[model samples]
Target: MTSPGVAPGLLRVQGLCSGYGRSQVLFGVDLHIGEGEILGVLGRNGMGKTTLVRSIMGLLRPTGGTVELGGRAIVGLAPHRVARQGIAVVPEGRQVFANLSVLEHLTAFARGGHGTAHAWTIDRLLHLFPRLAERRSNLGGQLSGGEQQMLAIARALATNPRLLILDEATEGLAPLVREEVWHALSTLRQAGMSMLVIDKYVRRLIGLADRHVILEKGEVAWTGSSAQLEADRSLWSRHLGL
Candidate 1:
């Protein structure tokens, strides 16, 4: 299942179906994230965008289909096993360890066992998130909302994953912080980090992501390049009601 492109994809998902309790959220969702490309998952709230991420991360078990990371079957595996396999996710709501200090959070989740490169070391993470460095000794709860979001991304990156999935990467942040986050994402893309970005910024997603997949009513209603999505504004207005 090789995706043809400049720098082919590292993550591939097909026929993904998942749910909470008995209520299914994702129904036959399909998507891919190229080796160095940024893929955006677009949809209105409660449209199953976050559920797709949870399924891929193994935080939620898929009722059907496969989630392959670097071309290996990972469906139904434990969350830690999935993370160990080089698939890391910054879940929605920036779930940082409230009891840990900023630096502690980094150290606790440091890269190990995988023998991956140190591209996301504490120093580099600090550089990427200067505010976190400023509050390195502060408890995670002591940081602002935007700062906590930064820490969440930094914590995920510190694992040095092959495919990074960010659920609502820039949600609820101030405009300036959102800009900073977009800047960091752009830099990561340039550095050849494959990412699955979920956000509501249509205009910016068009610029940053190489491809786009829109989830509607728990299904993949649209899939194409960013240009295709931008060209068809009606698609968004019709499916996402944006």
Candidate 2:
């Protein structure tokens, strides 16, 4: 089902319930991201932010609810199947292959003929994150945390996904590096790339995302435009513990 009063979006989650080993996390959560829209998911720790991303990525089987991409259900599909369906996730912790070089990472996951003329080629991704270009021959394990994060995002983009989900993309990094990452994201936004961004940097998220979804205890406590969220500080304190 579509979100009330909103058109069907590129990705939609309705009454989504999920958990690990019977410990339920998400509870009837609902949110959507329109084409070329950026949706920010915000919450305090243990509030099921990652759980929601995992459920969408098909990493964890949801106990109930529906997950749809481009209006098609993908509830029980495998993780790879979900990726093939045009959803790519830059998981928390920037899980780059330790043994792979920067060039290898992009080439291995590149999805040819699936993207527009602006498709993320290795050179394009390197252009987006120039440090990665300089470190093309460097192994993933040798890069700094910020560089690793950049690579993780680049690898996901290589798939040319219709929707990109970034779980805590700027969790731990220097201020400069975080700014770099945010700049790349803003550039992607300008290019009309749809994204679901999960980051603790609410201020930055407000500047980047078109809309926001605040998750509290596995449920969507509030959702609104960036302007609305920016004007409501109580929502920030109550739901986000900011």
Candidate 3:
């Protein structure tokens, strides 16, 4: 299911349908992210944004459709299997271990991934996230929300994942902290780390992401470049309530 200009592999979702019990959330959602591309996922609350992430991460089983990561179907696979397949997710919540030190949290990923020479190492991650380095010994629960969010990102990078999925990366951070998080994401993009970013800041996403996909009622209603999205504010006000 290669899209025009999209290589064979990479992250591709085609007609993905998912739900919790009888409550169907995602309906025929289709989207893709390519190597070294930063793709934005945008939508208002209750629009199946997280559901799509869950389905991709194997946190939820898709009743219908396919999820192909790196040219292989990952639908119905366990979360660990999905992670092993080069997909690391920083979920909506930081979800860090309350008692684990920052160092321990990252070091736990013994089976590091991302085979490239510039793979993410703990030293590199600490350099990318200086705050985490400063709090290397601090327990996850001892950090502020922003710090925890940084830890969450650094922890995921530790796995050396080829694809990084960040759900609400800066959801509850202070303005300054939000800016920091955004800067880190931008840096990752520049470093050629493929990303699927879901943030409330639509304008920021449009500026940073190479492509944008807007979901409506569990389906992709609009997919285009930043320039295309910027030219049409109606799309924002309609699907995203921007």
Candidate 4:
């Protein structure tokens, strides 16, 4: 599903390579996410999953390769510039500001969501995440782990991005809270929100992602659809350590 007058996919990272200082992490990584499609990035810890996300989000500049959003080159842009291209992220570790209230966090970077008929406004976000609404007056440090994850997501949604990236989406959340987060993600997918999800729950990802990209030591180790992944359990056994 291409955006009007744009290409079919929301994101494309071709031969991506980057790292801190000279310690190269990502090595020629390649992947894509179509509009309204969900792509799961899976790998063991330190395999460059977050590095890829950081590269795409302009948190790190790639030493080689290209990053395209809606078919336009976005490599070497500033984080704000990349964000202006209608991208948002729920970074790993939540990164919630202890001083900010739930409402403050949500409104920090309010940009009416793109490519959606129903943009993610504060009211809409509150409705979507009732717990956040309940804790609207609470400080970020006051909320539980589940509440923080929801807040992080809500903060991103408030920007109304065309592509939403969630690093370690369900990490550290309670089982029930993870289910809640996943359920919300499923709803967003159905609502046509293109997403790149990184999570440890392989089984849940198999059901949620339209496609999967397995990163092994910062490289594209495997790429396939849910059906292909499910048909080959060896993928998990070998690459994911499942």
Candidate 5:
């Protein structure tokens, strides 16, 4: 079920199906992201974008299909176990703790005792998002939407994951703030970080992701390279409701 021309690389999700109770959302969704590659998930609202991510992260168990990371089956693993397999998620809502300071948020969730040379440290994360550095002593509730989003991303990176999943990378932020988030993503890509990014900004996704997958009615409707996607506006109008 791999998309044509997409190598099943770092992360591979095949025929993945999941739902809440009896109401199914994702319908055999298939996608893959290679090492150092960014894959964009696109669709109109309620097209199973979040469900797909939840399934991949083991937040929700799938009724069928398989999810593999680096060739290891991770379908039924607990959420934390899946995360320990080198995957981290920046969830859709930018869920930062209200009482936790920026510094605490970074340090609390950081994966410890595995100090590689390139492991993400607080210093490195601060360098990535200087705004977080300036607000180190401030509670997560005190930061603006943009700053919260940055903190969420930084917190995920603190895990030093091999693969990162971001649901709604830039939702509900000022245009300028969105750009800043995009810039940080670009920086991560340049550093050879693998990412699965779900964002509403189709144009921005096209510019950032190496390939794109469009979901419709809980299924993957189309998937192709950025050049292929850019050339087909009809795909947008049909699947994404652009």
Candidate 6:
């Protein structure tokens, strides 16, 4: 399902280790995402899920290890530089600019030079998120939680990233809204958008992602297909305490 102009295995991470102050979070984390593949990173809370995403996005520098995007080393680059390298993140809590309008947020990061031609654009993002279009003039702080989540994703996509990394892809949202978020992800997968999705919804993730990586504490505890995950439910109960 690779797009005509898109390449596969666009992002790769090896031996990633990071933490806050003296508390180590991730240790020797290794993972990769192929073009058009939806890879799910599953684990319980405080299992270094957010830390892993932060390390890859350059929000936190890894104590040791390497991060590569499209075969280039990006381990210690700045966050802005990482973004320029075609990586975008929809962080947990949907942290949008509180005073900025919907249009302002989208246009702020619409730098299109690095992305592929015919990449995600303002019109396309608006089309994908109709609710955002309806509230283009509303301040980001005024939108509902679900709307903020949608805007967060739309804002990232507007950057035309090669890999979209979502941390806690769906958390604390109403059931119906969570379904909408998942449905949006399905649509993106069909459109050949590669993603590194972090979520607690293991049941639904098995159906959405092509591959799964379970993190125990901070290391890769298991890696396999969705079928393998289901066939071994004990695996989740053991490592994830689900």
Off by over 4 Å in 5: 1-8, 112-117
- Segments in model 2 whose C-alpha atoms lie over 4 Å from true places: 1-7, 113-115
Among the numbered candidates, top lDDT falls to 2
Candidate 6 structure quality by residue, lDDT tens digits, 1-242: 33234456588788999999899999999887877788889888888999998888888989999999989999889999999889899999899999999999999988673546567888888888888989999999999999999999999998888889998868988898889889889889888788989988899898898888999899899998888898998988997788
Instruction: Give the clashing pairs for model 1.
Output: 9-34
TM-score, predicted candidate 6 vs. hidden true structure = 0.93
Q: Which residue pairs in candidate 3 have backbone atoms (N, alpha carbon, C) closer than 3 angstroms, thus clashing?
A: none
What residue pairs clash in candidate 6, if any at all? 9-34, 9-35
Off by over 4 Å in 1: 1-4, 112-118
Tens-digit lDDT track of model 2 for 1-242: 33344455689899999999979999999988887788999999999999999999889999999999989999999999999999999999999999999999999999963456678888999999999999999999999999999999999999999999999999889999999999999999988888999999999999999899988889988989899999999998898778
Instruction: Please identify model 6 stretches exceeding 4 Å from their true place.
Output: 1-8, 113-117
Local distance difference test values of all predictions, in order:
0.86, 0.91, 0.89, 0.89, 0.90, 0.87
- TM-score per prediction, in order, is 0.93, 0.95, 0.96, 0.95, 0.94, 0.93
Candidate 1 lDDT by residue in tens digits, 124-213: 889988888899999989989999999999999888888888888898999999998999898888777888899898999888988888
Give the clash total for candidate 1. 1
lDDT per residue (tens digit) for residues 1-242 in model 5: 34455455789999999999999998898888887788999999899999998898899999999999999999999999999999999998898999999999998988852334577889989999989999999999999999999999999999999898999868999999999999999999888788999998999999989999999999998988899999999998888778
User: Residue 88 in candidate 4 has what lDDT?
Assistant: 90
What tens-digit string does per-residue lDDT give for candidate 3 at 71-139? Answer: 899998999999999999998889999999999998997355667668788888899988999999999
How much is the lDDT of residue 158 in candidate 2? 94
